[model samples]
Target: MLLVDHVTKIFDPGSISEKVALKNVDLFLNEGDFVTVIGGNGAGKSSLLNAIAGKFFINDGRILIDDIEITNMPEFKRAQWIGRVFQDPMMGTAGNMTIEENLSIAIRRGKNRTLNWGINRNEKSVFEKHLSELELGLEERMKTKVGLLSGGQRQALTLLMATIKKPRLLLLDEHTAALDPSTGKKVMEVTKKLIADGGLTVLMVTHNMKDALEFGNRTIMMQEGAIIADIPLEEKKTMKIENLIQLFEKKSHTPFANDRMLLN
Candidate 1:
């Protein structure tokens, strides 16, 4: 469902501060494939996703989603096929809007909007039903303003909003990094449930090694803007943490330096 070929991005080209964020990067994902990405700092993990999402134009190569070439497409035009969650919990939703109002916006993503009767009863019921599945009791507070919500609550809503329409590809950009362990785990559970229920394709970038191995069907480790290792489901099922650490060291020729990834 997704294909990236020899994609390259260089920042400040020809300058003393030039940085090659992505170098001949290539990756492919089949329909319903859930892949977790892991790497040390400066590994270009997020850059890969940004390139696919067309946040900025790449220097070379092509990107295709569901067989359509979108390498040159702008970010806004790609919104219908991609759902992205940033590291910041506050980035996804309108804080000042009520929970129901926020969901109404999400439901209408990529569709024309009008000021017709705001949030009908049927829509409210559907949103309530979906929120109840998170098991967070958000159903009781649909009328409450999102700004008044806790970080986890707002994040849960963000996840729901991102996937309400079953986006062709979902991007999770270290979304749980800002939350406490318990809350992060809850959000992950919601994420897994939602994806499984809809059979959505997902590419999630995470610095946490344990979460990276535990959640996705496949895992890809990158370093210096290149994919050093890509492990499939059968191999991943029996893969050990120690082995993974050693693999990264061998491939990158340097010890992993991310404490949150190594210690967690």
Candidate 2:
């Protein structure tokens, strides 16, 4: 469903501080594939997602979603086919908008704005059903402003918003990183449910090795802006954190050194 071909992203091209965030990186995801990305600092995990989302145009290469070229498409235009949730819970939703209001915006993403601004009964019913599946009692508080929600609640809601329309590709950038362990786990559960229900194609970058291995059918390790390891489902099933670290050292010729990733 997604193809990233020989993509390279270089920041500050001719300057002394020039950094290549992506180095001819190539990746492909089949429809319904859920791939988890892992890497240390400067490994280009988030950079890959940003490139795909067109936060900035890449210096080289092509990106396609379900056969349509989107390499040079503007971010707003790409939103029609891509849905993303950021690391920061506060980044995804409007704080002042009520729960239903925020959902209404998400529901209308990439669509033409209509003259009628009211949420119809059918739309409200759909929102209630989806919120109820989160099991957070958000269905009962649809009138509450999103700003009043706790971090976990907001993140869960963000997850729902991102998937409400089932975009062609879903980009989850360390989505559960900011929540408490217990809350993060809950959000992950919701994430898994949403992905499974939609049969969505997903690329999730995460620092936690355990989550990376446990959650996805495939796990990829990146270093210095290149993908060093891509473990398929069968191989990933037998892999553990230690095995991943060993593989990283083997391929990158450097010890796994991200403390945040390790300690998590």
Q: Number of the top candidate by lDDT?
A: 2
lDDT of 2 by residue, 1-264 (tens): 899999999999999999999999999999989999999988999999999999999999999998999998999999999999999999899999999999999999977768567999999999999999999999999999999999999999999999999999999999999999999999999999999999999999999999998997999999999999999999889988898889989999997777978445
Please list the C-alpha lDDT of all candidates, in the order they appear.
0.91, 0.94
Q: Could you tell me the TM-score of candidate 2?
A: 0.98
lDDT of 2: 0.94
Off by over 4 Å in 1: 115-117
**Span of 10 residues, lowest total lDDT, candidate 2:** 255-264
lDDT of 2 at 172: 98
